[model samples]
Target: MRRQHLAEEIEEIFRCSGGTYGSPKVFIELVRRGRRVSVNTVAKVMAELRPAGRKVRRRRSLTRPGRRPAPRISSAGTSPPRNRNSSGQAT
Candidate 1:
């Protein structure tokens, strides 16, 4: 009866926050509205609702390795010394 009403209100709050508000924020909102609710209860309700937030995309690497293998420096001094370009490619 009363529990069902509280669950509905929690669901509403979760939805109103663009589905980004987790249990802590939801619990705070409920408390601010003079609702006496436990954090655990809010967490439980949120788990049941399963509202999803936006997924964070990982930043792409700007300096990926080139297809060419790096030229090895020879200790035997057989090969002529090579100048390296800004991209670490042998010139």
Candidate 2:
């Protein structure tokens, strides 16, 4: 059985954060509100409460886009040039 009151509080905080806060954040919020709960316990509670609510947003690229497009590799199915002698004959 869950601690009904703590679970309710966790749910409230999680909902307030638009379901973006994971265990760490939820735990921090709970501590901020004077709740003496461990982070691991909060994580366990969250895991049970809303398994699908934790959505990891994609990380944005730190570097800016290049001015020029990237150089494309030739896929012409051509092999590397053969080794040639000084007279241009295949060695």
Candidate 3:
């Protein structure tokens, strides 16, 4: 549960932060708004008033290459190690 005035501050934080600020940013914003306010109070109020962030959906590509038959390979095993150059890593 949140205090009524704290709820108003949460709304003000959302307005100033443009809905992008989560607890961390909103906490800092609250500190900036007034010297007397503490970050913990802002963080708690923001958590109750608004969601942290919206779920992000990745774009799926339906335009893929047509199905094709697998190719035959003579040896599908790892190749033999080659000589390394001046660098310590393998060539």
Candidate 4:
């Protein structure tokens, strides 16, 4: 009986936030409205109701093929290795 009322309240808050209010926000709203409810209870009710918020999608990187040629790195051991300590300081 009480759960049903709480569910309704949760739904209303979720709707009011344009479905962006997840469990935490809903729980805070409930508390603000003078309702004695735990965050866990709100989370459980939300899970049961399944009112999911729309996730903000990340923007895809717009990369264009380089017009200039890439700098060539010589992998061949052309340069002599430097004697460095474990701390990377030149011995």
For all predictions, the C-alpha RMSD in Å is 10.8, 8.3, 15.3, 12.6
Error of 2 at 56 (Å): 4.6
Candidate 1 lDDT by residue in tens digits, 10-71? 88987898887778888999999999989998888777877655555799986777766689
Sort order, lDDT high to low: 4, 2, 1, 3
Assess every candidate by TM-score. 0.56, 0.57, 0.44, 0.61
* Candidate that scores best on lDDT: 4
Clashes of each: 0, 0, 0, 0
Given candidate 1, what's the lDDT at residue 83? 96
Q: Write the per-residue lDDT of candidate 3 for residues 1-91, one digit (tens) a residue.
A: 3477767876776776557666666666666667356767767766677656433479988766797768976666878668888887776
> Which lDDT tens digits does candidate 2 get at residues 22-50?
88888889899998989888888877886
| Residue-level lDDT for 8 in candidate 4 | 90
Question: Can you tell me which runs of candidate 4 are displaced by over 4 Å?
Answer: 58-91
TM-score of 1: 0.56
Q: Judged by lDDT relative to the true structure, which candidate is superior, 2 or 3?
A: 2
**Cα-based lDDT at residue 19, candidate 4:** 84
Candidate 4, poorest ten consecutive residues by summed lDDT: 61-70
Q: Order of candidates by TM-score, top first?
A: 4, 2, 1, 3
Residue 70 lDDT in candidate 2: 80
Better of 2 and 3 by TM-score: 2
